[model samples]
Target: MDHLADSQRVLTIGEGDGRFVAELVRRFPHIEVDCLEGSSAMIARARARLPSAAKVNFYHVDALNWEYPVEIYDAVVTCFFLDCFSDKTLREWLPRSINCSKPAGKWMVAEFREGVGGMERLRSRFWLRVMYLFFNWTTGLEAKQLPNWQGLLDELGYGCFEKSETSNAMIYSSVWQRWENARKTDGFNP
Candidate 1:
């Protein structure tokens, strides 16, 4: 959360069970957070997890259809959330989602990724397939494979400045900032 220490407003999409939100508020009590979650059950769990005094607004809505406020947030966070959608959905949804943040905003993402090489790649592929199959069967998730999220973010004019991988490179966390030129050319107005 060091990256968000100075942020006044933050948005988190599909933040399950409020663990991250609770920790976020605990670390930065001054920040106001808006959490968009599709599941009411998850939202209830999240609300129960947080102290009543927390500066959190829980929106029980799907990110794809939610009308995002214009340039209102300092950062956007998605943890294991974007992987639930198909590539086509992401291409259309991500730009709109990121638009809610200011021109100099940060986007923090933690999600599953295919491994780099060798046995790591093979192991990642195996686990990913299993995960997709399980989630598809249980949750009716539309994504059968992980998309090139990094490439898509690049196209959206964001550049990754910090990144790390764990779980044998099957999972990654990264921080991204909008390119200076993108601020002027991306066409979103504050």
Candidate 2:
């Protein structure tokens, strides 16, 4: 969360149970945060984790239908959240979500990814498939595979400037910033 220390305002989409938000507020007490979560039970659990004095606002609403404020946040975060949806959903949702941030705002994402090559790739793909199957069977999740997040981010005019990955490259966390001259597309206005 060091990358987010300088942010004055942040938005977290699908911030499940608020573990990351709690840590973020602990480390950067000065940053104000807004959490958008769809589940009431998850929101209640998350609310219970933070002290009453924490600077957080919880919005219990479906993320896909929520009205995002324009140019309001300094950073937008998604941790293990975006992977729950299909690429078609992400293409329609991500732009609207990112548009809530300022023109130069940062987008931080933490999620599972397929490895680059060799046994790592094989192992990652195996685990990802298992995860998809399990989640689909248990929760009726629609996504069957990992989306091309890198390509989607590129198309949306964001560039990854910082990243870290596990040894197997099955999981990754990345920080991205929109290009200075990037055009706002997909019906989202700057």
Candidate 3:
């Protein structure tokens, strides 16, 4: 969130209960936000969390069906959200997500990652399996394993500018930026 302190327009996908959104609004009162979530209940909860004066547009729509337009946002965020979809779904959604950002826009992501090896890998896998089972039953999430979002981000012209990990690499939060020298289109000036 600190990386985006200067952003004037942000888009958050699956903003969940809106805790981050609320905090972002408080931290950067000048920014406008487009908050997208699939569940109306979650949307309502998120909206309630925001300050009454914050400028946020909440959209209750599936990310897959969102009409992503080019050069629309200064930053895009997804926290514990992309992991819900299968790799194929991510392949389809990621490009759309990046397409919404202006050239060199920031993309922030927070999600669990499969551990590298040893006991940590075993423990991480166990917890992830449990999560998959629970969310599959309770929320109908489709993915059984984490997708290679980093690779896709690279393929789509994003470069990791900052990254942090926890739980022995079982989880990670990263901020990637679309290349500053990326071709400009339709008056995009990043």
Once fitted onto the true fold, the runs of candidate 3 whose alpha carbons sit more than 4 angstroms away are: 180-190
43-80 in candidate 3: lDDT tens per residue?
Answer: 88898888889999998888888888789889999999
Q: Model 2 residue 34 lDDT?
A: 97
Between prediction 1 and prediction 3, which has the larger lDDT?
Answer: 1
> Which lDDT values do the candidates have, in the order given?
0.88, 0.87, 0.85
The candidates, ranked best first by lDDT, are 1, 2, 3
Question: What TM-score goes with each of the models?
Answer: 0.93, 0.92, 0.90
Query: Which candidate model has the greater lDDT, 1 or 2?
Result: 1
Error of 3 at 69 (Å): 2.0
Which residue segments of model 2 deviate by more than 4 Å?
A: 181-190
Give residue 96's lDDT in candidate 1 (0 to 100): 76
**Residue-by-residue lDDT tens digits, candidate 1, 6-99:** 9999999998999999999998999999999999999999999887789999999978999999998999999998899889999898877778
Model 2: per-residue Cα lDDT at residue 21: 95
